[model samples]
Target: MYTKDKYSLRTVLLWTRRYIYIFVLISVIPVVLYQLAGWKWLHLPWRPIGLVGTALAFISGFKNNASYGRLWEARKIYGGIVNASRLFATMVNDFITNEFTENNKTDEELFLIRKTIIMRHVAWMTSLRHALRVKKPWETSGNNTSDKEHMQSIHIQEYKYTLEEELDGYLSDEEKNYVLDKTNKQTACLNLQSKNFKELKMDGLIEDFRHMEFKNIIGELFALQGKSERIKNFPYPRQFATLNSFFVWFFILLLPFGLMHEFEEIGISLIDSLSGNEIYFFIAKNFIWLTIPFSIAISWIFITMERVGDVSENPFEGMSNDVPITTISRGIEIDIREMIGDDKTEIPNPHPEYNNTQM
Candidate 1:
């Protein structure tokens, strides 16, 4: 996600430049037809266009609110994952002990078991984020030409590397093969974790009650994963999104037509005031052409708001403004590895930020 306090005006202009071109064309045409071609009948009643604009405002507000709700929900789900990862690491380090084992393993052996479980949990997170990053049919954040260009400067690690490459050191060769064979690798990773915890209990490395606690934690992870998947799988209602676009465009097209007569009246008033000055009277006579820039500015606001809602609707689409799942997962790995006293050199560093953006 963008880490800066605000996006610069230059950046916003660059991202929406294409729409500006369209708006200028849409606005200029009616003004040219009215002023130059003498099509005075082109102007529509101001009241009808005002009513349409008010309706468009309400629809746009509804869309943006719903989109923000989805984005916030996705972030909270990952927040839960972050907390659960830390708790799991602490439990593996402290709860499993030789105090209850008849055949005690060495401290080094115990450490190895703790490291394995922790590392496997990292694999689970990696799989889950990669799964979310996979593009859905309805997701359109980076699909447009302008968005694709904007995303070039932002690094999305999931797009660059294969899941197998990412899981190399985290999963054992046999476990990697088992996970790769499954369609849902995240689910497979969690199943391996569950089996490992059960075996640890069977061998008396963990108490029976502690085993139950571990199971509970696993169940929570499953719930969190399911929540994430639900958002990724189901998109914002297409009917609303589609209709919102249509309404915004309808209003933009009607704006210049409505402004024609409004500006004409303003020009007439100005001409009357400047009647004694030749130069001022000439400038005032052509004041109706001011509709072009006014229409462009107003239309830009509506179109930009529509685009904001569109991009925010899918928080996992790898856009710069979406949730930084890659960075969050890497951070969790770092924190949990440190909890287990793993060598600092062995643990991977946090993912780098690009252009004040994380992904």
Candidate 2:
């Protein structure tokens, strides 16, 4: 995501530079041409321009409010994911009995089952993050958290690398095929974890009551994954987007003519010292040129803000303003491992070396 301090004059200028030619052609050149031809040819009533500007402003305000609502909703959905992930880990650690009962399964079996479920829970978080970002689960790499050794032992590396390479080769064929494959992998991983939990219950390593408790948490995690997918796939209405574009362009087009009427009415005043007509024309020329640049600058600001809201509404896109999904997944892994009697040393710390890498 963009830093909180990213909104500044320099940032605006940088964005403007990217679309400089278009702004000049649409907003600047016409005003300059009209000024050169003399202000008389451009004259139009100020009242109509004022009315149009007010209407455009109202539309822009409504659009911004609607976009922000979507953005907030997406953030709340991810918040649910974070809570559900923690709940899953907690249920696995606390609800399952470590000791064997009359059915005769050992503590070791129970431990293995719990650990496997925990790892799979971690995998689910990672998979969901990748899914929302439209990335393959295997494409991500690095020390997202401090527990590299445990992650490697679980075969996260080999599976990820192999799958990622295969995905990269297959992406050209059809995007849906690749997405379907990844989704299957996520489901398969969750199923394996669930099977391990069920086996423990059958063997009497965990009580039937405890097994059900953990299963409920797993169900919640599945629900959260579906919610994230909904946000990623569905977007705000296209008509709302079209409306905003139309109004912004209309306002720009009508501004120069609006100023022309004011100049014509003030024309007689210029003759007391100089020709009132010439003075009025000069005022009209300067105002029109000023309006062009000012309008372009304001439009750029609005466009940039709208674009940011668009990206933030689905924060899994690997864009600058997207949620740090990889980072969150790593945090879930570290937290689960630490809770399960693993030594703190075994779990990696957060905050890998930044070096020169861009976030």
Candidate 3:
């Protein structure tokens, strides 16, 4: 989701700060205490430490690989949604030609059908994005009434007024109000579209050509909806995740003890000649030196991998490197409106700030 020219080191560090702290605490504190206590008796076995370190390394690699796979899968699914949306727009435009030229439906009825379907498509995209992010769609909609008073105070009115004005005479007040109340505009639009399709069928306007065309478009929409749901519901395997995390933590915990056995047994004067107090200090110092930096490095890898998993699990959240759902949704709305031969101005552009960067 990040839109900058490149990823920032500052941002990466910020996201992984918590893990870094854990590594420092595990590695540094013990070493510092050892230096103060002058401990020299503490020691660990080299062979076991080496084995643990090796195992930890393997676990880190596997976790990174697994996380990347989830991220890539999420990307692919969103890509499919994008393609399907475009295809649906094309079908709608082609199938819903000036209905009067070949049918009994008036210009007004045909216009309503086209506009309603297009708007509904837009609403659906917004709703799906909200659902993915676990946010309320209505809250994000610019015309939300809870924020209406604030907008009014600042004299920063939104498009609600204009939309209402446009539909004034064509739709009843109740219908107009209903549309305005809808937070998931795209879903609402789709429902209207389905109803319109049924009406066309009942009125004998569902000629073979148009029927097939409309059916394909509806099919694409349904497919897109299913795909989004799949991404939301189906995540990476839980077993793999649990195993990888367990090994990583286990390795970190045992690392200091392993190093102590290997290095302390050397019996160098610094450790062997020390008095009781000094001996403890020496042992603790060695422990910390071995523990802190290595723990930090390993912990950093685990933390980064975990974060990658989190981002991958919800690709549509508009997070850094996550799918640009808001932009995609806006693009769909624009393309559909253009296809319906409506003025480009009728389709509101997404916020410039949001479109420019990954949230």
Candidate 4:
């Protein structure tokens, strides 16, 4: 996600330049036909176009609100994961003890135990982020030519490594193989964690109540996973998205037809008021051409709003505007490892950002 205070105007304009080109063409066609081609019938009435614009405004606002809701929900799910992970780490570090075990382990052995569970939790996180990054048929974040080119400036770490490769240092060979064999790797990792905790409980490493508490946290994580998967799997209602696009385009194409006439009338009034001034008359005579820029500006605003909703609808699509799951997962890993007193140097650095964006 963008870490800067806000996206620069240059970035926003560059990102939408291709669309602006199309808008320019769309706006120019009708103005040329009406003014130069002398096709008087090419101009449209303002009332009908105004009605369309008003309807388009409502739908655009609705779409943006829904898209923002999806984005915020995704972020909140990750926030819950962050909190649960911290709690899990704290419990694992302090609860497992000789107080409940007859066969006591050395301090080093206990630390190893704590480290193993914590790392597996990190593995679960890695698996989840990787799963979420998997492309769905409906996700179109970087599919466009412009977006594909722009994505080069942002680093998405999940694309750089396979799940097996990322799990290398975190999971044992047998566990890794077991996880890789599963349809849902994150669920598999969590299953492994639950099994480990159960074994620990049986061996008296934790009291019965504490074991139940761990199980509850595991269940909460499972619920959070499902929530993330739900959003990733099911896209924003395509009916709304598809129709919104049609409406916006229809409005853009119709804009210049209505706008050129209004400007033409204004130019006529100006020419009449400055009847004897040749320079003012010349300028006023051609002022109808200003419709091209005005139409483009209006079309750009509407189209940009529509595009914003489109991009925000899928928060896990690895776009610059997506949730920074990679960074968040790494931060959780760092915090959990520190909780267990892992060597500071051994913890990997946080994922690096590019162009003030993280993925």
Candidate 2 off by > 4 Å: 6-9, 100-112, 135-182, 256-288, 343-359
- Which one is best on TM-score? 4
Cα lDDT computed for each candidate against the true fold:
0.91, 0.56, 0.58, 0.90
TM-scores of the candidates are 0.96, 0.72, 0.70, 0.97
The Cα RMSD in angstroms, rounded to one decimal, for candidate 1 relative to the true structure is 1.4
- lDDT string, candidate 3, 57-100, tens digits: 67656766765665677667667777777777676665665452
Alpha-carbon deviation at 296 in model 3, angstroms:
1.9
lDDT: which is higher, 2 or 4?
4
List model 2 lDDT by residue over 214-275, tens digit each.
Answer: 67766776676677677667765667766766776676566555653454344434434454
Candidate 1 local accuracy as lDDT?
Answer: 0.91
Considering only N, C-alpha and C atoms within 3 Å, which residue pairs clash in candidate 2?
Answer: 1-320, 1-321, 146-348, 146-349, 147-348, 270-276, 271-276
Q: Give per-residue CA lDDT, model 1, range 104-123, as digits (tens).
A: 99989999999999999999
